[model samples]
Target: MNFFPNFANINECLEWVKRKDLALAKMELICQLLNHPEKKQKTIHIAGTNGKGSTVAFLTSIFQNSGLQVGTFTSPHLDDWNERIKVNGISITNHEFFLISQQIMSELEGKVQPTIFEFLTAVALYYFAEIKPVDLVIYEVGVGGKYDATNVISPLVCGITNIDYDHLNYLGNTLTDIAQKKAGIIKKDIPCFTTETKPQILSLLQKISQEKQSKLCKISPAKKFIFDSSQLITNFCLTAKKHTFNLKTKMLGQHQIKNASLAVNMVLYLQKYFPQITQSSIEKGIKEAFWPSRMELISQEPLIFLDGAHNLGGIKSLIQTLKTFFPAKKPIFLISIMKDKQVDKILNTLKKIACQIIFTEIPETRRQEISKLKHNNTAKFHKITDYSKAFFSFYSLLDNQKIGIICGSLHFTALIKREFLMNLNEKLNNFSLSNHQPV
Candidate 1:
C-alpha cells in the first residue's frame, strides 16, 4: 500500500497476475478491510463482450435525465484514467481520485497488494458510498463476470449485452463457455436481462437464472425500426410488459437499437422500485447518450469516422453501419490491431468493403506488428509504422468520392483522434489570425 501512496503511482501497480483462482477472494478481503463500501449504494451490474460500454452509457444518461445522481464504472478508457468512473456523466476529479486512493491505502495498511483494476474498483465504491453519495451506481464488469472484482456486490438488477467471441484466453473458446462466464454475475433472486437472441445462448441464460430463482428477461429490437442518417439518428419502438415506447438514439448501427432497447427495458423494470423515471426522461436520455470511438464521425468534409471494432462481433457491426450509411462508397481504412485479437478474421472481414487499407502501429506494446498485417493483394495494402504519417497518407488520398475510416484498435483510434483534433484546432487558429490581420 505504501508503494501506491499517490495518484501517479496507481498506474505503476500490477494490472493482473496469472493466479485467477485468488482474484475474487483477494477482492473480498480488501473490501472487508474497508468495511465493504460496495454494499452501500443501490447498484445495477452489466456484463458482455461487445455492447457493455454503450449499454452503460444509455443507462447512465437515462438515470441522469430522470434527475437521479447516478454513478457509473466502466473500463479501458480512451484517453483519461478518470473516464473509468463518473457521476452524472462527469468523471471523478483527479484530486478526488487521489484522496480516495490515499484513504484505501491507509485502511489496508500494506496488508493487501491489489491489481490496478482492483484498487480502482475499491476507490469507485468508496467514492459513491462516502465521498459523493448517489441515488444509484452502475457497474460494468471489467472482464468475464464471475471473478471480476466488481462482482462482490449484489445488484438490484443485472444484464448481459450479447456475449460473443472476444477475450477467448480468459473467458474460453466456445460460445457456451463464454456465456457461462458472463452469466456469473447472476445473483440469488436478483432478476437478470439480456439482449442475446441466439437460441443456445438464451437457453443457457434461462437455465442459469432459473437455478438462481431469478427471472430472466430477454430484450430485442422491434420489427418496425427506422434509421435516418440525414440527421444521424435512429427511431425505434419497443414494447415491454405491454407498454410501448417510441425511442430515438443518436448512436448509429442496428446493433445499437438492441443495446438501447436493453437499457430501456432495464429502466422500465426499475420504475417499480424507483418510480420517478418517466417516459420523457427515457426518450431524452436515449437521444443524448454518447459513447466515444463507436462509429464516431470525426469529420464531415473528408467523411472520416472512427470505430473501436477490435473483435469479430464488433467488426461485423462496424461493417454493417458503414454499408448502411454509405452504400456506394468503399472507404480507405486506417487500421491497427492488437496481437491477441482474431487478426486474420478481422482483417479478412474489413477487406471485403475496404477500397484500400493503411496499416499503422500504436505505441502500445500489445499492438500487432506492421509486417504481420498483410494481405494477398499487395495493391490494396500499405504499411506505415508511424500513426500520424499513416493518417496523413490516407487523408491526402481522400476526395468527395472517397471516404476514410480509422478503425481496428480503440487505442490506435484514440491516438489518431487526439492528433486530428489538435491539427484542426491549429488550422482554425491560423485562419482566425490571418483574417484579423487583413482586416
Candidate 2:
C-alpha cells in the first residue's frame, strides 16, 4: 500500500542504466512475479542500430488506426516518463504511474531484483493487460535484442531496422556480432522485416532467420518523393505493387522517410496475417503516429532543435537530415553524450556542420566529461555543468537568424526537453500574471 515518491519513480529508473549488467535475470525475475497465466499478450519486437524508434512509432500508429486496440512500449523517453508506455496513444496518468510503481516496488522489494528497464517493462505489460487488452503490442528494444526484456514476448512481427555498431561494450565490437545479437529477436517461425541491409549484416540475419524457420523480408527503401526539406510541409510518396500513395511525415529527415517505409512494410506484413487491417487503416496509422525529439524543432528564433544521435549511424542520419533541412545554412550545436560513446567519431561528424559548439553535461553518472571539448578548436566551446545553465546559455546565443541543435544523447535530449522546454507556454503565463496590471 506504500506509494513511491516522484524521485523514486524518475531517478530510480534512470539509475538502473548505470548498472551495465546485460543479463536477463532481472527481467525474468520481474516477469515471474507479475505476469499472470491469463495475461499472455502478442507483441512486435523491434531492434536495430537506428530507426527502430521511428519504426515502432509508425507501426504503433498504424495498428491504432487499424481499429485494433494497441499497446506500445519504447525506451529512452523524451520529455516525460509516460511517453515510454501508451495504450492507443494515451499515456498512463501520473496517479496510475504511482500506483503501478507501488505494485512493482512491492513485488521487487527483496524477493526479486529488477533493473529499471525490467521494472518498467513489467509495469507496462501489467498496465496493458489491466487497462486495455490490446490486440497488438509494439515494443522497441532498449538495447540489443537477445537479452532485452521485451524479447520475452512472442512477437507476431519482428523488425531489424538495419544493424550497425552500438552498445558495443555489451553487444560486441564487430558489426556481425552486433547484428547477431539484434537478430536474436527472430524467434522460431516468426515473420521478420528489415530495412535495406549491408551484405555482412544481411547474411547474418539470413542465417538466423533460416535457423529459426522465420521468413525474412528485406524492405527496399522505396523511392518516395525527392524530399525537399526547404518546404514547410515535407512530402513523399511510396509506390507499392497495387498502388502508389502520397505520404507526408509529421517527422523530418530522409531517414524518417525510410522509416515510414519500414513501418509500411511491417503494417502490410501485419495485415497479411491479421486480416482485419485495411488499406485505409494502414494509411491513417502511418500518418498519425508521432514520435518526438528526433529532429524536433522547438522554436524558430535562434532555431532550437533536439535529436538523440548517440551512435555513429544515428549521427550520420542526423547530419544528413540537418543538411537536407537547412540546405545552405549551418547550425550551432549544443551537445553532450554518454561516457561510453565514441566521442571522437561523433565530434568529427559534428565539425562538418557545427557553426559553433558548446559542451555540457547530462544529469547522469554516465555523462561524458565536459573537459573533453578542450581538444576541439574547430568550434567555440563552453562547459555548462547543469541543464538549466545549459539551456539559458544556449538561448542567450540565439541570434534570431541562426539555429541551435542539441544532440549526441537521447538521455540528454529528454532531460532538456522535459525540464527546460516542455511547458514553456504555461510558465510564461504564470510569469505574465505576476507582472500584469489589474484590468
Candidate 3:
C-alpha cells in the first residue's frame, strides 16, 4: 500500500472526502491566506437539498445569453473534478486545473491542512478573481450553508431551492433544523429568493431573513407550465410580474419547473445591478439550457432514461415524473445508492414502480455494499456488484421492448455516463445521442 504522494504534487490536491466538524476555520484561513480573492467577485449563492444544480444551470444560461461573463462552481461532480468549475458553460481544462491546484498546494505547504472542499473553494474563488475576468459567478453550497467551504462570500443575492431531508447527521433530524442550516446563507440587507413550499421551512427562513435584516422573496411555480411529453420539446411558460414568456427545455420532471422558476426569479432580483438581462434573453437561455443527468433520455426505442435521484424526496419526484411521461408503460428500474442515504425508504419507494430491480455499485468508496443489502420480496430484486455488466444486460432487455430507467446515486449515474453513453450510441440503431454533455 502507498500513501502521501508528496503534498507538493498536484495529484495530492485532487483527493476528496466528505468533511466532518461543521467548522469554517480551515476555509476562512485558506481564504485569508489567499488574500480573500473571493471578495473581488460578485456571486449568487444557492443552497438546498436538491434542485441547486438545475437552478445554477438555468441562471448560468440566462447570464451568458445576456452577454455577461459567468463563472459557476458546483459540487459532488459527475465525472472529473473539472466539472465542478466552469466559466460560460465550459469546464476548466486539464492544464488550468493542475496549475491552480499546484499553486494552492504551494501556498498551504506545512501551514494548514484544508479539507478537499475548502481547498477547491479557495482554488475556484482565486481563479475567478485573479485569472479570469467574469461579470458574475454562481456557486452552489456543497452541504449545509453555514459551515460549507463555499459559504465564504457575501453574495449579491441568495437563492435557496426546496429544503428536504438529507445529511441528517450533520444538518439535523428535523426539517426545521435543516431549514436553519440552509438559511445560514441569508445575510443582512441582501435580497434572497427561494422556492421552498413547505410551510414550516418557509416560515423558518422568513424569520431568519427578518432577523438578519435580509429581504426574502418567495417564488411561486409557473401558473401555466406545460409538461406534455406528447410535445416534442418540453415548454415552460414562466411569468414575472406582467412579463410572460414561453421557454423550451429537454429537462423533464415537475421539480425542474420549480427550479427554473427560482432561477428566473434570481435573475429578476439581480436586475437592479445588471440591467442588461431582459425577458427575451431569459427565454432564449431557458430554451438552450439543459442540465445533464436529471431526467435525461439516451434512447428513443425502449425509452432509456437516467436520473440522479438519491434521496427520498427526489425519488418521490422521480416516480411522479415517470407516471407523467410514460403513463402507459411500466419501467424496469436499475438502481444503486449511497450508504448514508435513507436506504430503507429509498428501497421502498422504488419498489412501488419497479417490476424488476437491479441493484449494483459504482466505482466510488461511499457506495452501499451488495452483500449488506436486504433481500426484498416486493419486486424481482437482483443484486450485482459490477454496474457496467448489469447496465449492458438492462440495455439488451430494453432492445427487446422493455421500458427502463436508471435511478440511483449520482456517482453511479456518472460512472454509467462516462463508460456506457458512447457505447450506447455505437450500439444503438445508427443514432447518436446529443443529450449527454461532456463529463
Q: What is the C-alpha lDDT of each candidate?
A: 0.86, 0.76, 0.82
- Residue 127 CA displacement from its true place in model 3, Å: 0.3
- Model 1: per-residue lDDT, tens digit, 220-282? 777666777578788888888787888888888888988998899999999987899998999
Which candidate ranks first by TM-score, i.e. highest? 1
Indicate whether candidate 1 or candidate 2 has the larger TM-score: 1
| Model 1 misplacement above 4 A | 1-21, 374-377, 425-439
TM-score of 1: 0.90
Please give, for residues 197-239, the per-residue lDDT of candidate 2 as tens digits: 6887888888889999999988776554565545444577776
Could you tell me the C-alpha RMSD of candidate 2 in Å? 8.8
RMSD of each: 7.4, 8.8, 8.2
Positional deviation of residue 28's Cα in model 3 after best superposition, in angstroms: 1.6
TM-score per model over all chains = 0.90, 0.84, 0.89
Clashing pairs in 2: none
